[model samples]
Target: MSPPPPDRLARWLCHPHFFKVVLLLALVISAPTVAIGFYADDYVLLSYLAGRIPGSPPWYDLYNFFDGDALKLQANLVSGFPWWTDPGLKLHLVRPLASALFTLEHAVFGHAPLGYHLVSIALYVALVAAAGRLFLRVLPGATGALALFLFAVCDNHLHPVGWIACQHLLLAALPAVLGLLAYLRYREEGWRPGRYLGPLGLGVGLLGGEAALGGAAYWIAYQLAGPVPPGRAAGLRARAAAALPALGLLAYFAAYKAVGGGAANTGGYVDPLASPLRFAAAAAERLPVLLGDALVSMPADLTSALPSGPFVAVGLAAVAGLALLYRACLPAIPERERAALRWLVPGALLALVTSLGGFPGSRLLLLPSLGIAPLLAVVILRGLRRGPSPGRAAWPRRAGAGLLAAVHVAIAPLLFLAATASSADIARKLEGVARTAELGAPPRERAFIAAASDPMVTIYPQAILGLASPDALPCWSALSMARASHRLTRTGPSSFTLEPLGRTMLTGAFETLYRAPSAPIPRGYQVTQCGATIRVAEVEDGKPSRLEVDLGAPLEDPGLALLSWRDGRLRRMALPAIGEAVELPWSPGPIGLL
Candidate 1:
């Protein structure tokens, strides 16, 4: 029943058990989709990319956010970014190939919620299946199976995998894992020119999710740590050929910089000005959070059940467990993969340290978990390898293995259900707001809509649909309005605001332009369907100027004034009549409700 060497991959990927596990995990983890719908970012990004909204993000719009001279009303326009739309910031493009996936998907799915959801699920299963084969090949018997099952049922993945907009992570990860698996296969057989395809896929996958870059890192580490096979000279030559694509990527980055791609702001973490101690401390503080998020649940998710004192203890203990497992299993591991253990350290570092930069969400942990899963599987398999021999010690080892397996089996499904439940909760709230946008979306200028409950869902509550295109009257989030009030004080409305936040205030759907902040102010600011800034309240000695200007209501436009009120709250003001103008006193900061 043993699979042939070449057929090894097929055995894991095509096995009946893989299918069964995928089905069960899908039912458990994605059961929430029954109630789940498009969420905050999904409505905006998907619609725009699919050109379902006015002022859609054209191809290469990500960089346009940085391009000062880029087209007007481009959703991502950055009029005056301090960094000048640095190329490092748009690192998202490394996975630009993923956009093609979305394009094809929407062509078939046509933005149907069911279609997007199913596609997302299918990609998730595909990623886990590919990862399962790689782990099975690398790790000892039965280890990759358990690790893959845990990966399928992994708690953190629910948010990233279940959410459609977040499917980029899945798309990026699949190719990365595939590339690494292909590298391993080539390492076993002789490397050929076709092996170069592995690196090419990796390069594309990197753009999908930067975490996929780990696949390239892994290949490098494998060559370094793995013992050279016979014909070492020729073997490395073949690998060198495969490595050319990655080298070309590096060359591309160098060329990218030559083209004015802004330098990465490593100053925050890696700068000489930054205190090394503080950097490590900050990274340290985040490490536990990343670990906790990956190993169990987020602090927010566990706050009530697990108190701060015990939470730290559990987090540390979890860390301690890994260290101990590595020490215990270091001896039994096959020598070739034994050196490969070093990969786990960086992998853990990557998973844990990434938290220092961004918000500590489970999404951040997905890539690191990909690394962590194999390491954990190796240790578990290593321990089982030593135990359950045919002797007095056999029962003890068998009992231990059974207990460990039972815990993984039981906890996996529970974590999956918990992930689905958490998703369901967020979905319920977003559904009401999405419905509002679809039904009550306004059709004219000088208008804003209050979100049902979520503060982050910006723009109108509705998206208008036509046979070929979609349109809605311009709108504002509270943040957008505050930004408008602040920018009008200096740059005036219609001119591109030089600052980044001010830049977002200008949605590209409508035409508007402004002079620089230092330039002369216009008579008044006006955007056709959106509202305009009429005047700025001058402030001297920090006292409020409270300037007054009239915002005329358009006959066809919704006569709502977007205002920022006390405690950073935002609300809309209604005009008495369509032709009436609201003359209001305003300060330099965000304006408030009348």
Candidate 2:
């Protein structure tokens, strides 16, 4: 059917208070995330700032940030840690206020995960509210509600809100933008913008290094959507006026640095330039997971419900609706009206780009996504105006809205399922079973069985680390641990050690050898004796053994034998594959997974 008239659509949208009320209602509805568990990254940031150790450091703590690897940049900030090698490395350079606030929260909340979750949830709610406020002001007659929903769950943010660690993006962005919005409102009233001095200053100060980033983002949005000045001289003056806020933003950023204690050491991560290429290449290969992440962080079982098909569908639909609005309504918007939107959309885009430096995910995109709501609302409003008649106007908009809302409903339960389906609970149960299963065996007998069943904890020069099966542990944790330890330490140009190996190495190496690889055995084993070479046969019973070897011998073998180590219980086995390593199934006693 053909679309109805425009005036009727405009009349429907021009309702006096629907926008504000609906916006408020949405905030009220989604505010409960605070009650949820602190998802992953929330734990990391909070723990770091509060200086709490979750457990022993994994072997690679020397280079990893979680191990205090980022301590090199700071002048005097000493990291509190288990990984003590790089104590003052400055890893996080930009967000001192975030770290400081985390410390403050810890002081008040003291490792209560709930408190962190609540703060994150509250900030999310506030951000939603502020977005609504901005929408009401900028799009007064637009479909602000659609924009609000889009901001909430359009991307892979479902789990990000729940994840306690990654909520900093939202937490920092909310107050900073709300403060600017308030300042903008004050300015619109022709009130002395100086009255905003308090809120603006506080927001910037609280945000610290992020203040500049946040302010720059807001200014970009303002420039895009605020009124363009009348011609040359006036435009210059307007530009200068805008520059004032920019200056204020920059001043606070500098102050953040001056406050000292930037992030300790930037952690030895894959370089950003390197990551984008890897990400791009991995994009095609891992589209399913990538898209899945853009929707929610559910457990594997929940993936079926919120599958990639539906996520891509909703995302595409949202894009279509946005396109319609931008195409149809943008031309009709007044120069001044369009200014604010122009300021925000591009600004938000810029923020998104910067935030995605080496990685792009729901958590990283939260603020930028939230900031663009006003622009999106403007689009939806215009789309609504293009409808046929008053009765028909909202029908198309409603259809689009209904689909969007349904997506949220379909997605919410999946999020809950994910939170509950933790592998940690599974692993704990497994350990209990193992204790009973091995009951009454002699210590040596038990050790051999343990080694046979355990995941390898360490990979020596000749040995490879391994992990229990994914069914026994969560794939995420298994993968996480495996990745944490499989690297050789990079010493000066000439020196290196095997400590750089991360969790992935243990898992992969273990899986390969434990599962069996197609290769021939290198038959002979040689060990050093006092000025002599000695040969030893592979032990067949999978029991602990110590075979003496000659030292100072120039035999071809370099202690090249497979060993299964558990609680110091060692079993010598034939090294099956030369290029690949094997993993015994037992967990390591003195191992960490940071």
Quick one: best TM-score, which candidate?
Answer: 1
Worst 10-residue lDDT window for candidate 2 reads 461-470
Stretches of candidate 2 above 4 Å error?
1-35, 41-90, 93-97, 152-161, 194-212, 229-233, 248-325, 328-339, 384-594
Query: Each candidate's TM vs. the true structure?
Result: 0.64, 0.54
The C-alpha stretches of model 1 lying farther than 4 A from their native spots are: 1-35, 50-55, 59-94, 191-194, 231-245, 252-288, 299-317, 328-340, 344-360, 380-409, 434-444, 448-455, 459-471, 479-558, 561-594
User: Cα lDDT for residue 253, model 1?
Assistant: 57
Q: How good is model 2 by TM-score?
A: 0.54
lDDT (Cα, tens digit) per residue for candidate 1, span 29-61: 665553455654565556556555544545433
User: Residue 168 in model 2: shift from native, Å?
Assistant: 3.1
Model 1 earns a TM-score of 0.64
